[model samples]
Target chain A: MSYNWNWDIFLSPTPSGESTYLGWLLDGLQWTLTLSLGAWIMALVLGIGLGVLRTVPNRLLAGSAAAYVEVFRNVPLLVQLFIWYFVLPELLPTTLGDALKQTDPLAQQFFAALLCLGCFTAARVCEQVRAGIASLPRGQRNAGLALGLTLPQTYRYVLLPMALRLILPPLTSEFLNVFKNSAVASTIGLIELSRQSQQLVDYTAQAYEAFIAVTVLYVLINVLVMFGMRLLERRTRVPGYIGSK
Target chain B: MEEFDWTSIPGALPILADGMLITLEITATAILIGILWGTVLALARLSGNRPLAWLAAAYVNLFRAVPLVMVILWFYLIVPTLLQRWFGVSQSSDIRMISALVAFALFESAYYAEIIRAGVQSVPKGQVDAAFALGMPYHLTMRLVVLPQAFRNMVPLLLTQAIILFQDTSLVYVIGLADFFGAAYKVGDRDGRLVELLLFAGAVYFILCFGASLLVWQLQKKYST
Candidate 1:
């Protein structure tokens, strides 16, 4: 009860002279969005590839895809981020390692976080895609083949579109997870939203305000994403499909 | 690349084992507590009590919206002091673990609530109507007829969440608790063989979670009609 509350800490000039605490928080939010967006793109691309590979008839291709999912999905994102940030550069060839080490610190952190999140999320997305594809009728693939389409063409023209539509809900959840998991990047010095809130508390001691503000921002993002994905689900829904409503 | 050393691991195992114990303890405790609270919230949501439904909804929304790390930090900072004053329990050695448990339990309840709600909904409405027609009271109908079936259906989903909870226990490193991930981090930092130590740690997590999830996948396949 005796604790003093400071709502104006955001307005106070920061010690770094760049901007106030509000700016720092916003900057952190920007990093979070950038990291999540970048990771999502990577997740979709790699995830779809791996997902497709997992479903392919070739034992080797499917095995490798399953291995990728097992490796990336099982590891903790924090551990993976550390490996990416610290161990990976060292594991590279000496010249490449030195080059990575010499890059600008912020860019280095950014890329490390981005790659870490992307690959980690890609595993979950791969599972979603695999399930989606698996849920389609066997007749569909047979139908595509019966129409004189090559296997690749059949997947591209028929199977993938239907599967992707069915999987949108799970895909949306994975997308939201990327935003939430981006918080782990702060451990490796990425300065995203969670890190910024921690820093704000350290500097201003307004733990309640800093965290409440950050929480609200996160809720806004989550709500927006939920609504947006719901709209997409409605737009892309196939009539008579399961879960269309 | 430098030559790899494997000897550091055996030396670190005892500490790492302790950390693993903590991680498992937290996961088990949180799952139990979270499921209990989640069942209550799910029932409230389904009970047609508007105010109770809204309150449960808000808790679920707020907890789900925020990151678990923030919740952990909030409880770490806020709860111990309150407990100390209110309960007169001294700030004991297990405070960190206690706070982590509370936060994980509370945060995970939101997720569990959703799963339980879905499970409850999956049971046919006609089942409830039959129980009512048989002169079963509402509470007895839920407790004796509805809940058992709902819980059976929910077991796989609950286990899946527990697997996720196991992995997330690593995040306790943020608060300086030496859970499995924290143990690896510290030992790695101390010996300067972070690559080897972390690789070993990642392998342990992978084996445990991947194995458990394989079981879940099997169960899901078995249960699916």
Candidate 2:
């Protein structure tokens, strides 16, 4: 049994002649990084808010935060992407829906995918944040309160700074996961790395080479992030903290 | 801008329910196979054999580092050919489900291996020493003393991972198998009621996963003692 192998197809220009196949993939890589980093910013902000709310004394706020985490975390990312892409625009008022529809298609897909991934990863990050806060000594909160700090100020000056540092290791994993999870955006036509590979396979019929290239890129991203986080962890480690080692 | 129609759901439920079964079947089979495979990997990593430990670690690391969707796509493209050459199973028969099952199980085993390894390590070393002191053999000590405690400690984690696996089962749609998510997408596209059908699908997924997570929380509480 024999099969044709073409390692050089990526260098060949596409039928459109605008760019080579490798250019399309690099463009896809650019989008993947952009989307992942974009969504990660959203996840960190929303997750921190929700996580703080979960630890607050107000039952209503905490309950709502918990509910948000439960709903978002339970649904699959692909399903959520579909909802954001196809269903959400229609669900809005006609003026809003029409405005969204009138926007460029790629922009719409990018926004929908970005929001979907942001919200989805936010749920996971919320849990990590909650766990980090909860693992702190109860007296830490009390000390801040006793020191005349308001609740918000306490979280800002006392609880959160320590908690964030404590959770860096888990946060690193979550960051890596966001990059990996960005692949689901391709289902919504976002043209990220996985979709680019699929398109490469379709145009070139080089399934092995396409997928292997995508896999290597993914690994490279993950490894780079892992080492970066390890260095950050080492530099920022608190003496006698949980992950100081 | 169309009127939000709820009636399309009932018409779509039966087909979607069939797809849900396929999703559930794939998830269950994968969880079982993954746990079995993960247990072996966990033991091999702990077995003090350098090559075996390296092999298990490499497998876990490679699978963990890559996205599950890519793994599914790879298996879809490659597994059938390997299956045919090795087992003489013709490619004509429906192999999508089998390929999905194999991919999910293998991909998930990496995660499960880490969880089980942690669980095994959580068991006190003294217990193994005590078992050996009782003249129990290595396999017997592991089977009778270590594994039971380790599994008990890890039940909640295992269940949580299973729920994650259930959600990920939707990725099988890439291979064009009509799992729950695929069925919804197809029915939505066919009838132009994508909004209603997909909303319904998301709700179903939410309920199942939320319910399972609640069960996992309860298990954690129960086992915390």
Candidate 2 lDDT over A130-151, as tens digits, reads: 9989999999999999999999
- TM-score for candidate 2 (chain B): 0.96
Residue A162 displacement (Å), model 2? 1.2
lDDT of 1 by residue, B1-225 (tens): 556797899999999999999999999999999999999999998888999999999999888888888889889988888788888985666889889999999999999999999999989999999999999999999999999999999999899899889999999999999998899889999998889988899889989999998999998999878
Give the per-residue lDDT digits (tens) of candidate 1, residues A1-245. 66778889989988888899999999999999999999999999999988999998999999999999988877778888888998888888888899889989999999999999999999999999999899999999999999999989988999899999999998988988888898888888889999999999998888999988888888888999889999999999877887743
As a whole number from 0 to 100, the lDDT of residue A203 in candidate 2 is 95
- List the pairs of residues colliding in candidate 1: none
Q: How would you encode candidate 2's per-residue C-alpha lDDT over B1-225 as one tens digit per residue?
A: 658877777887899989999999999999999999999999999998999999999898889888888899999998888998899966666789888989999999999999999999999999999999999999999999999999999999899999999999998878899999999989988888899988888999999999999989987988797
What C-alpha lDDT, on a 0 to 100 scale, does residue A221 get in candidate 1?
A: 86
Name the top lDDT candidate: 2
In order, candidate lDDTs are 0.91, 0.91
Native-referenced Cα lDDT, model 2: 0.91
Worst 10-residue lDDT window, candidate 2 chain A: A236-245
